[model samples]
Each structure stands twice: as structure tokens, then as C-alpha cells.
Target: MLPPVKKDRVITQLPQCFSPNAALHTKDGFHPQVKAMCQFQRTATVSFNIAKVIVVGDVAVGKTCLISRFCRGAFDKNYKATIGVDFEMEHFEVLGVPFSLQLWDTAGQERFKCIASTYYRGAQAIIVVFDLSSVNSLAHARQWLEDAMKENDPSSVLLFLVGTKKDLSSPDQLSQIEQEAIRLSEEIKAEYWAVSAKSGDGVREFFFRVASLTFEANVLSELERSGSRHVGDIIRITDNTDGHRRRKRTPQCC
Candidate 1:
């Protein structure tokens, strides 16, 4: 596991999820309530040591593109493929809790198959992305789901079905194809979402939904740790070490 924080603070407990929702990946699939990112208030970054994430998908499904947009807030239209796994990090505060996401975007081609397993280890969340235009990539979600489940810490690991490049697909086609993909996500007890990295559609939502889920998981983990061990001077709000380095802003409490 990476260092809990780039620098561990003397403070004890951190704040909990500011979002009111209790769970993610419901029977309805995509969340209708999360209209925009749950942004934080302006404060000095106080890094909290927290969760990790992994992004998985078939080649050309916009996995790397999604990370680029989310982490760097920039996009590239070029088609250079990821050789193995592309990496990026972002620090943000949620519900007054500072957190960092070490996002690993993996290669989807068959030649890169062996590398996926190694990357999947110790992942707190797995995003399985598929192209809305390709039945083959959409169908591949099954394999991606199974491989993610192989890691098997259901409570800590989140499995999400991400449909990429919605801009290229006709509206009818996008909805029709997404319905089928969401059905599969449901079958596997996962949530489904559509995004267009090029157009900046659902890209942030896709990641924020995962962050919300991870936020809940982190709170629970912290609670468990607090109960099991005793600590003093705990500040409810905290930012991760990497978060401190990534962003200077602090999150507001709900």
C-alpha cells in the first residue's frame, strides 16, 4: 500500500462523506441524484491518507482519455495507444475529507493481457469501460467484471461498467447499446454509466460516483480503525498526502 499520506499528520480521525446517499450501484443503475461533483470549500489542503483506484477497458474505449480529462482537466484527440498502463494522480477534498486517487489506466489489447492482473491487485475500485460503438468491446465487459471480482474484497472494491464515446454513437444507438450493457452490469451486481471523454460528458460523474462510493468505504474503514485502536486529537476533516500535493483547496462539510 502507498504511504497513508505523503506526510502523516498528527491529527486522528477524518471527516466522513458529505453526500447524503447511503449506497451506489443501485437497481436503477446510474445515479440520478448526483447532478454535479460534490465540490469542497476553499481551505488549506490537509491531506488525508485514503483510497486507490484502477481503470480497465478495451483498447480505444477512452480509458486513458477519461483519466486525462479528470486528473489534468485536459483532453487530447490523438490516438496513440497506451503501451501498458498509463498513470495519473489527483488530490481533492470531499465532505471536508482530503483524499487522493492514484488512478491506473490499463491497456486492453490481448498482448497486454498479462499485465492487467498485476495492476488489478490492491485496487479499491475497478472501472470497466467499453466502447458504445463496438459490440465486441461491450461484450468484453463480462470478462472485465469477472477479472475484477477475482480480487474479491467486495466491500472495498467497487465494480463499475463504463460506456465510453457516447458522442460518436447515435442517440438511439447509445441508449440501445447502453441498455444492454447496463443489464449485464445489473446481472453482475454493478452500476452502469455512459461517458464521452472527447465531449467531457459524464466523465467527471463517472469518477465522482466512484469517489463517492470510495468515500463511504474510507469512512467505514476509518471507523473500524478508530474502534479497534485509540488515537488522540483527531480532526474530522483531512486531505491525503498526495492530495495535499495535487490540489491546494479544502472541501466543505455538508
Candidate 2:
């Protein structure tokens, strides 16, 4: 059963409200099977940059749907309450390097707030979504950002304000939505986008920008801790199947 939603979320920032609640005991959709594989196996040429990212927004603004579309390339119209937070792992190769992202999708309902913020703490990037059809949700976008920022390291959290349900946006609804997003983004200093999660619009580029920002963020974070400007590269060599040792290249930022 889901935990009862707390009314004393006195902190306007829901993400901050989540600070007191540790992660739920249940790892509903989290699977780290590959971690063991790497630990047990000797893979000398393995390459990847793994990062944790969390997606957040107000209830019914399509947080779940957007995640479905982005990760699975599909959507579900049926209504099913997210018991807690859900997760997906996506691996992609970009710019001759391999990257993996742990994508977290949190329940947006007011009642599930307790379980939501726990996942925000270590996120390298965040996507804050709002519904184009609802002004109230758009207004709440800042609160989402605040909550996420509270749990995460502010210096490196690459946040983007996405106006979802753009397929429903008409010419009449377009200007006001754009202005509100732009104004709020400036106020909070966030990047804003109009996207149709149903049509997969702006989804790829959204994360592409995030990946680029996070890659840089990782480098800066390493340098700051080590007091060194240069992040190194990882070059591993191993004996091949039928031949001599082979070399593998991976970016070792910081």
C-alpha cells in the first residue's frame, strides 16, 4: 500500500518537503543487475558514463506519460496511480563515447509527495514538466524546481522547464503559455521548452542538451574536488579472444 500523503508539507517546495522522508523500502522498478555483472566479470574494455537523472512535475501533467514515451517510445492513455517512483535505464552512444542514464519518474500526485523527493537528491539533471492547458500547473513548476534543487547539488543540476501537452496547444493558447514559461524561466534562471510528449517532440533534444550539460558538470565537479583542471581518460588493455592484449578507451573525467 502507498503511504498516506502528508498534509504538513509546510515547505512550499515539495522536493524540500521530501527531504525528511528517506527512500521507500520498496525498490519498485529499480534494477541494478549490471552492477553485479561488472563486479563479477573481468571486462577490460567496458566503457560508459553513468549518471542519475530525475523527472518531476505536478500531478497529471503527464510525468508518467512523458517518461513512457521517452524511454519506451510509447504511451498509455489509461489511468494507473504510480504507487511510488518508477525507473528506467537507457544506454546510448554519443560522440564516440558510451553513456548510460538512470531515469527516475516520480509520482506527481499530492499524496505521493513523501516518496518523490528522496529520489531527487543525487540527480545530475532534472526535467520539470508542466501542462500547457493548465495555468495552475505552470505556476507550480517553480515549486517543483525548488524542491528538486533543495535535494540536489545546485551547482550541477541541469534543470529544464518543459511545457508538455503541446499537441493541445492552439494559436490562442500558444502566446500566453510561451510568455509565462519564458518569464518564469528568467525568474528562476532555467531553460524552457514547449514539447508534445505524445508526439515525442523536443524529448530527444531535451536530454541531449542535458547530457551535454551533465557531461560538463561532471568534469567541473571532479576538478573542483581534486583541484585539478584536467580530467583524465581511462585506457584499459586486456588479452583478446584469439590474440594479444587489446586496448580500450573511455573518458575518465576528473
Could you estimate the TM-score for every candidate? 0.73, 0.70
User: How much lDDT does candidate 1 score?
Assistant: 0.62
**Any runs in candidate 2 off by more than 4 Å, and if so which?**
1-46, 227-254
lDDT of 2 by residue, 163-236 (tens): 88888989789778878887787667566777777898876555555554454455445445666222232211
RMSD per prediction, one decimal? 9.9, 16.1
Cα distance off (Å), candidate 1, residue 119: 1.4
Q: lDDT, candidate 2, residue 112?
A: 72
Going through the candidates in the order shown, the clash numbers are: 12, 0
Backbone clashes in model 2: 0
lDDT by residue (8-105, candidate 1, tens digit) is 22111222321222224333221222111122222433435356687887888888888887766688989577766666666544454455667877
* Candidate 2 global CA lDDT score: 0.61
